[model samples]
Target: MRGRDEDVISGRIVEVEAYRGLEDGASHARFGRTQRNAVMFGPPGIAYVYLVYGMHHCLNVVTEVEGHPAALLVRAIEPIAGAEWMRAARIAWLASHAGNRSAVAIARGRDRLIAAPVTQLASGPGLICAAFGIDARDNGTDLCDPNSMLRLEPAPSEEPPPEIACGPRVSIGYAAEPWLSMPWRCWMKGSPALSRPGPKAAGTGGTDSARIEGTEPQ
Candidate 1:
C-alpha cells in the first residue's frame, strides 16, 4: 500500500491525446504502430514510454482498457517529498546540456528558481520527468502493482477547490489548430502548486493574481 504521502506524489495522472499511427496529425506512431507502440496496444494501467524529439524520454499511462491504444501523457509532476533530490537531478541535467560559462551560471542559478508546487514541475514534458526523477527505467512498470516504483495513488483530498478546468496541451504545434484548441489539460484553480505569479510581478507595477490552467482533471 502506498503511504498517504507517497500517494500524494504518485497516484494522480494527467492525460493527453497523442496522434495515432500514420493518419495522426501529431504522433510518432503516425507512420505505423510498431514495436515502439506495443505498449499502447497493451492493457490499461501499463506504462507507455517513448522517446520525444529523438532525445528526451516521455512517459504515458495506457488508458481505457486492453487493446484500446490510448494513454495519458505525463507532462509534468510536482515534487512531493524528494524535492532536494529532484533539484539535484534537474541541476545535473541542465549542467549536461549547458554549453559553457554562461550556461553553467544559468544552471547554477536555477537552484533559486521557483516552479509550480503542483505536479507540473516544469510546463514541458521533459523537464517534468527530470524534476520527478522519472526515466526509461520506469517504462512498462505496472502502476497497479504496489511493489512497483511507479504507482498511482489518490490525489490529496485537501486540494484548493472543487472546480476543474481544461486547456490545450502545451508545445504540440504539430497537432494543428483544433487539436491545439482542445481543452484536455487540467489543474487546480488557485493552487500555488499548480499556479505561480508571472515573471513581471517582481518588475514594475502589476497586480495580477495566480491563474491556473492545464489538462482536464480525471
Candidate 2:
C-alpha cells in the first residue's frame, strides 16, 4: 500500500453524492449555494455530503475552483484494514434484513457478501465506506488534512495497462443529459473486473479501478 491509498481509506467521510453544479442540470449547486452547500465554496479536497432518496447517504469530494462545485463521487474503495470488522458490520445488517436461515446464508455466506481483500475491498464508494467503517458519524470530516483519516491519494505512479478507458458514470440516471455523458467515470480498459465492457482502444474513456495497477501488492 502507498501513502495515497492510506490517505483515502483511513480518512472519515459520510457518503454523499454530488450532481455536478449550477451549469449542469444534475448538480445540487444548480440552485446556487446555501448553508448546506457552503463547503462547495471552498477549494478542492473537502467533503460534500447530502442525504438522498430521503434515506441513504452519499459522499463526494469537492474539486476544481472554490465556487465551482466539481466533485468525484466516491462510488467504492478497495478495503485495506479492519476487514473482518467491516464484514461483520455488513453481515449484521444483512442478517437483520434476512427473514430465514436460507436468506441469511445467501446474504452472509455468498462470495459477494464476503469482505474482499484490502486491495480489492473498497473498489466502489459504498464498498469504501463499508470497508473503512465510515458512517453518518463521519459526516463533514476534512480530507485534505494529513492528520485527518480521510484524504485523497494520487493514483499510483506506475502506469496501468494501456487498455484503461473512461465512460459515463454508472447508476446515475437522475443526472440529466450532458452530466451523464461527461466521461468522469474511469476503469480498466479491458479487465474482466469492469462491470461493462470497455472500448477496444488503450487508456481512453474507462474509469480507473486498479488500486495500484502496474505494481504488485506490498
Candidate 3:
C-alpha cells in the first residue's frame, strides 16, 4: 500500500479463507448482493473491505467471474518492509481505539508496536488493515491495477513457496453444518503470523456452536 505521501508498505499474504456466496453459509453474500457486499459480485481481483466489531477492518479479494460472488479473506500477512511506518500507523490506531489519546499512552502504544515481531506486525486481517491504513475507502479497488494505492503483486520468486495447510474457518458459529465445518481456510504451515496457531478440525472437539469470538455477522 502507498500512503498519501507515497510511503509504501508491503507484506506477504500467509493465510486466507474462501467464501462462496449463497452456497457458503458463512459468506456475506449468502443472502445475495447488497450495497455493502456489491464488490464481491463484481469482476475478479477487486477488493472487498469491511468493518468488523465496529472498528477493525478486514480485507478480502474478489475471485471468480462477475456475479459469482466468490472471495478470499486475507486472514493473515507477514510484514516484509516499512516497519517504522507500520509501527506508527498501528500505534495511532491503538491509541484511537483505546480512546486514550494522551501522549504517554500513544508513546506506550508506539513502543509496543515497534517491539512486536515483524511477522506479527500485520498478522491478523484487522491488524494488517490498521498497519497499512486500509479501510472501507479501499473497497471495490482494482487490486490487479499496478497503479492502485493498495494493489496485489506477484510474490518474488527468489525463494521457494511455503507449504500450505488447510483447516476450518474461524469464529463462524452461526454458519450451518457443512459450511461451518468446511476446511476452507488455508495458511502457510508453521507460520507464526497466523491469527490462531492451531486450527481446529471438525470432530477434534465438541460442536458447541456458542463460542463465537472476535467476529460479527458476515
Candidate 4:
C-alpha cells in the first residue's frame, strides 16, 4: 500500500476465505451480476472491496476467469514494512469515526498504536483496510499491476511459505446447510495474526447480520 506521499507499506498475507458465484450461497453473485459486485466477476488479479455493518470495509482479490464471480477475502496480514505509516493511517481512520480529531486524541491514539503488538496491526479484514487506507474507491484496483498503489506481491523466492490450514468460512450464518459447513477459509497455520481461531472455535454465528450490497461477510 502507498500513502498520498507515496510512502509504501507492506504486509504478509496470513488468512483468506473464498467465495464463488451462483453455486456459492454465501457469495454476492449467488443471485446474478449487478453494479456492486461486477468486480468479483472479473478478469482476475484485481480488487473486490465492500463495506460491512455500514462501516468496516473488507478487501478481496478477484479470481477465476472473466464472467466468473469468484474472489478471495483477505482476512488478515502480518505487517512487514512502514509500521509507522500503517499505525498513523489506522489512528487517523479511527479518529475520523467521531469527526475531526484533536491534537490530544491523535497523541493518545499514537500511544495506543505503539503499545499494541505488531501482530495485531493488520490482523483482521477491517483493520487491514484501516491500516492501508483502502475503501470503495479501490474496489476494482488492479492489485497485480506494479503501478497500482495498493499492489500485491509474492514473497521472496528464498523465503518459505507458511503452512496453510482450511476450515469453515466465518460470519456467514445466512448461508444454508452444506454451504454453512463447507471448509473454505484458509489461513497460515498457528499464525497469531489470524482473524479468528479454528472452526471449532469460530462457529457459524456472526456479530452483525447487516450486509453491504449482498457482498459482505455477515
Candidate 5:
C-alpha cells in the first residue's frame, strides 16, 4: 500500500508498458532532454509522471542506468486496500474539477450488497492515480524509500511472485512497425485488472495474483 496515516490505498499491479528513449519513437525522450522528461533521465526507483490529454496523469517507473531514459508505464492495477479512500479521492477530484455526477455515483457505489468491487477501483492509469491520490506532485516521487507517501514495497508474502508476461503496449500506434510490434509491456499474467486485452501470457490464473515483490520501496 502507498499512503500516510488514515488514508492508505493499495493495488495489485497488473499491467505495464516499457518505454525506451532515443531508440524508441514512442518514448517522450525521442526529442532528447527537456523540462518534462527530465526525470526519466535521472536515477532509478523514482516516478516519471506526465500529463496526458491535458488531464490524466500517467505514472512511469524509472529504471535502468541514469541517462538511458527507460521506464515502465503502469497501465492498470486492482485495488486491494483502502478502497473506500480511493473512491473518495477520485470522487472529490471529479466533483471539484469535472463535476461528473454519474462518475462520482459509480465511484461511490455504497450499496454494500451491490457495491462495486474494489478491484475495479483502479483499472486504468488515470483511474489508478486518482484512486490512489497520485498526481504530478508525485512526478519525482521516490519509490525506493519506505517513508515516502508513494513507495514500492515488497509483497506481503513469502512465496515467489507470479510469472511475468509481455505484450505490445496500448496506444502509440503512431510509433509504427517495429515499435508497434515490440512486446515490451509487462504484467501479472491473466489479471482481470489488465487495462485491455492482449495475447495470453504464461502461467496465469487460478489463485495467483499480483503482489509487491523484488526490491520494494525503502
Candidate 6:
C-alpha cells in the first residue's frame, strides 16, 4: 500500500521472488552487511524497499528471523483500490522521464500492442511500486504494523492459497552459475500479474500467509 496521508493505494500481491543470503549470488546481502542492506539483516515482516536501474523501487519482505539477510521481492499485484491514482502516477512518471513515446502510447492505449487495463497496471515490480507510489522513502517500513500506513491484509478469499508454481527468477544473468537457475520464485498458479511466467511443478498444497511476528490475528 502507498499513500501521502489520506489517499491510500492498495492491491493484492500475486507474484514474488526469493533471495537467500550467503547462497544467492544475486542478493545484495550475499557479500556482507552494509548500511544499504541493514534492513534485510533486521527482523522479518519489514519492507526492504530499494531502487533499481535508478528508475524503480522494488519492495521486498524480510524473512528468516533476525540477522538473516533474506527477502522476497514482491513482483506483481492485482489492484484492489485507488486505481485512478495508480494510472495518474504512471503517466506522471513517464512524462517526468521524458518518455513521450511510451507516455503517448499509454495515453492512446497503444502500448504493449493493446490498451493496458487497470488490473495490468501493477503487473511488474517497478510498475507495482509506481502504481502504489512506493519509493525509497518507504524503505524499512514495518508492513506488519496495523497502524502503519502500509500494511498487508488478508485476501478477499477465506479459502487456502491458490495452486502454486515455482520457477527461476527474472533477469539475473550477471549473477552466473546456479543462482541464475535456482527456482526460488513462486506465484499463484497462473496469475496475469506475474512479471514473467513458465511451466509449473506442483507441490501438494498449503496456506500462504504473512505475519508481523508479534500477535497473530485472532
Q: How far is each candidate from the true structure, as Cα RMSD in Å? A: 6.5, 8.1, 6.4, 7.0, 5.9, 6.3
The true-versus-predicted C-alpha distance at residue 212 of model 4, in Å, is: 28
Q: Model 1 TM-score?
A: 0.68
- Compute the lDDT for candidate 2: 0.55
For each candidate, the alpha-carbon lDDT, in order, equals: 0.56, 0.55, 0.82, 0.81, 0.76, 0.76
Candidate 3, residue 108: the lDDT equals: 78
Candidate 6: where is the Cα deviation over 4 Å?
Answer: 3-6, 99-114, 200-218
What clash count goes with each model? 15, 37, 0, 0, 3, 0
Model 1 bad stretches (over 4 Å): 1-24, 99-123, 156-162, 176-178, 193-218
Ten contiguous residues with the weakest lDDT in model 3:
208-217
- Per-residue lDDT for 46-121 in model 2, tens only? 7776655543455677876776666767664444445565566555545554555686467546456674443444
lDDT by residue for model 1 over 76-138, one digit each (tens)?
454556555555667677666665569558845575444434344544567656665667777
Candidate 1 or 4, higher TM-score?
Answer: 4
- lDDT (10s digit) by residue, model 6, range 1-218: 65544687788888889888766798989888888888998999999999889888899989768877899999989887788778877866665666546656665643441346787888899988877778888888888887777777676587687866666778887797778877777777667767764353424533332212332221
List, residue by residue over 1-218, the lDDT tens digit for candidate 3. Answer: 55433467888889999898677999999889899999899999999999999999999999879978889999988777786778778888887787647878777777877789878888888998988999899998999898898889888788798867677888999999889988788888768788877445524544422232433243
Instruction: Identify the runs in model 5 with alpha carbons over 4 angstroms from their true place.
Output: 99-115, 198-218
Q: List the residue pairs that clash in candidate 3.
A: none
Per residue, candidate 5 scores C-alpha lDDT tens digits across 1-218 of 58776667777788888887677888888889899999989999999888999888898899867878888888898877788888777666565654445764744543431355666677788878877878889999889998998888777798578777665677898896777867777777657777765453434654333333332222
Q: Which candidate is the best by TM-score?
A: 3
Which of the two, 2 or 3, has more TM-score? Answer: 3
Which residue segments of model 3 deviate by more than 4 Å? 1-6, 100-110, 199-218
What TM-score quantifies how close candidate 3 is to the native fold? Answer: 0.84
Q: Estimate each model's TM-score.
A: 0.68, 0.64, 0.84, 0.83, 0.81, 0.81
Candidate 6 whole-model C-alpha lDDT, 0 to 1: 0.76
Quickly count the clashes in candidate 4: 0
Per-residue alpha-carbon lDDT of model 4 for 91-160, expressed as tens digits?
Answer: 7887777456787887787788878888788889999999888899999999988888888888889988
Shift in Å, residue 22, candidate 5? 1.3
